[model samples]
Target: MTGAPLLRVRDLNVRIPTPGGELHAVRGVNFDLNPGEVLGLVGESGSGKSVTLRALLRLHRPPIVMSGEVEYGGQNLLKMSEARLRSVRGSQISMIFQEPMSALNPVLTVGEQIGENLREHTALRGRAAQDRAAELLDLTGIPSPRARLADYPHQFSGGMRQRAMIAIALASEPRLLLADEPTTALDVTIQDQILRLLLRLRDELGMGLILVTHDLGVVAQTCDRVAVMYGGRLVETAGVHELFRAPKHAYTLGLLQSLPGAGAQRQPLQPIPGGPPNLRALPPGCPFAPRCAHVTDECRAAEPPLREVAPGRLSACIHFDELPALRTELQEVHA
Candidate 1:
C-alpha cells in the first residue's frame, strides 16, 4: 500500500463566483496521498483546505472553475467524464463532509442513506443491504444500530451523525477518504473517539485519508503529515512532528503561537493579527504579506512559489530564514 501514491494533485486551482467577483479559493495546491497515509490540511476558515480537497471529487457546482492535474490510477480526474467521475467517487474515493446533518439527506433515514451507498457501489441490496447498514453503524461504535436504522438525521446527536457519515463513506471500501472536519461540531471527548475510530478504520481498510481541519491538536493526534494553508495557498508542509516541533513559515509559526497550550502558564494567547485576505482581491504579491510582521519590499513585489527548504519539507515564504528569530520573539511575547 505504501509503494506508490494513491492520489497525486499538482498545480490545482479552484475559482468560485460571488456577487463581487470570482474568488480564487485554491491556487496551485499540490499534494500526494499514499495508501494508509493520513495527511492533515491545517488552515483557518476560508483558507481553501476544503475547497482544495473537494476538487478531487469534483464536488463543486457551476460558476466554479477548477484546473490542473488530479491524477489517480493513471488518469487525470479533472479531465474525466462526469459519468466516470461519479463511478470513481464513493466507489474508490469517498468524502465525509463538514456538517453531518447537511451531508446526510434530511429526508432519509440513517439506514437508507448508508444502504443507498451500498446499493450504488456494492452488490448489496434489500435485506442484505439493511443488515450491512446496521453492521456499519455498529462498526462505527453506534449503539443499537438495528433500532437506529429507521432514525432520521435530526434524531441523532452531532457525534452520532458524524459516525454515520463515516460509516457511509466506508460503504464502498474506498482507497481514499477525504474527511472535511468530521469532528467539527462534536465535543472534545466525542471528537477524540471519532478520530480514533477513523484511525482504526483506516488501518483495517488501508485507505489514505486527507483530513481537512483547522485544529493543530487534531493534526498532532491523527495525521502523519500536515500541510499548512493560508490565503488560498500552501504556506508550509512537513511531517506532523517536524511541523509542530519547528515550523518554517511565518503563518505556520503564527498558528502555533495562537494555540493556548503552546504558550507558557499566564501567557496570553497570541492570535495571528489581522484577517485572512479576501480571495476576490488577493494581493498582487504574497497573499499573507499584509498581515506578516516580517514583510519586506521583495515580499510585496511578487508571490513566492512553494519550494523545498529541506528534504521532505516545503515553504512558500520569501523570508523564511527570518522566521526562526520571529518565532522565538512571538514565543517570548506570549510567555
Candidate 2:
C-alpha cells in the first residue's frame, strides 16, 4: 500500500439522467487497489458499490456520465476510445457479475463462451481454446470440467453457474478482477466455497480484486481491506482487521452493530436510523448526516472530505473521535 497502486481511482463520480432528475450514483470516490489484494466495497443496497465498479469498465449505458481518473498502469480508462477500451476490458480487467445466468449466454455452450474469450484475448484457438476452457473450469473446481463445458447456463446449478462465471472471467488472465456480489445468491455453504476459491485464485494469479458486497461477514472472510459506502460516498476505509477493531465512521459502526448475534438470547439489533438519502436531492452537507447519531451542526453545514484519520485509514467524519467510542456504546446497547 505504500508504493504505487495497481489501480488508482480519484474523484470518481457517476451521474445518470433519470425521469425524475440527474441521479448521482457515485460521488467523489477515491481509493487504491494494490496488486493481489482483495478490497471489499461494503454497503447496503443502492449505496453505489456496484455502480462504482461498473463505471470502471464503462459498462453502464447512457444517459450516464462519469468523471474521474481510473488509472491502470498509467493509462486513464475513462479517456480511452471504444476500440482501445474494449481491448483493455477483458484482458487487463474482468468482472464476475452478481448473476451468472444474466451474464452468461444461454444459447452458447459454456465451453464456447470461454473459448470465445480465449480466442479474443489470447492465441488459443480451436481445440486449444476448447482444452483451455475446460482447464479453466477445472481451476474453478467444477466437476467433470470437460463434460460440463458442453452444458449451457441453464444446465448448471446456482453454485455451478457462479463457478462457470468465474472461469470465464479468468480466461484472459486479467491483472485485476471486479467481482460484484459474487456470493450473494449462493447458499452459505456454497458462498464459503466461492470465497475460498476467490482467495486461492487471487494468490495464484497475483491479481488485484475489488469485491462489491453488502455482507460484512463476507468482507471479513474474503478481503484484505474494506471500504464502507453510504449515500454514494465512501464513509470509511481501512485494513480489514483495523476497520473491524476500530472503525472511524459512524456509518461503519452502525453497520457492525446491526450484524445478528449467534446467542440464543440476544438484545434487539441497533439498526441505523432512517434510510439512504435520495441521490437526486442529496442534503447540502454530508449525505449520511440524517442517519448518523454522531452528526454535528458542522456536519450538516458542509461535506467532510475523506481525510486520513489514522495510518492507512480514511474517514469522512468531522467528529472522528467518536468513532472509537461506538464499540463500547454498541456493546452496552446490545448487552
Q: State which candidate has the highest TM-score.
A: 2
Encode model 2's per-residue lDDT on 247-323: one tens digit a residue. Answer: 88888888888877644565588999889899999997888899988888999999898999888889998887776
Candidate 1 ranges beyond 4 A from true positions: 262-266, 325-335
TM-score of 1: 0.94
Candidate of highest lDDT: 2
- For candidate 1, write residues 240-331 as lDDT tens digits: 77777778888898888777654444457788889999999888789888888888899899999999998899999887777663233323
What global local distance difference test value does model 2 have?
0.89
lDDT of 2 at 273: 85
Candidate 2 regions exceeding 4 Å error are 263-265, 325-335
lDDT score of residue 254 within candidate 1: 87
RMSD of 1: 3.1
Error in Å for residue 164 of model 2: 0.4
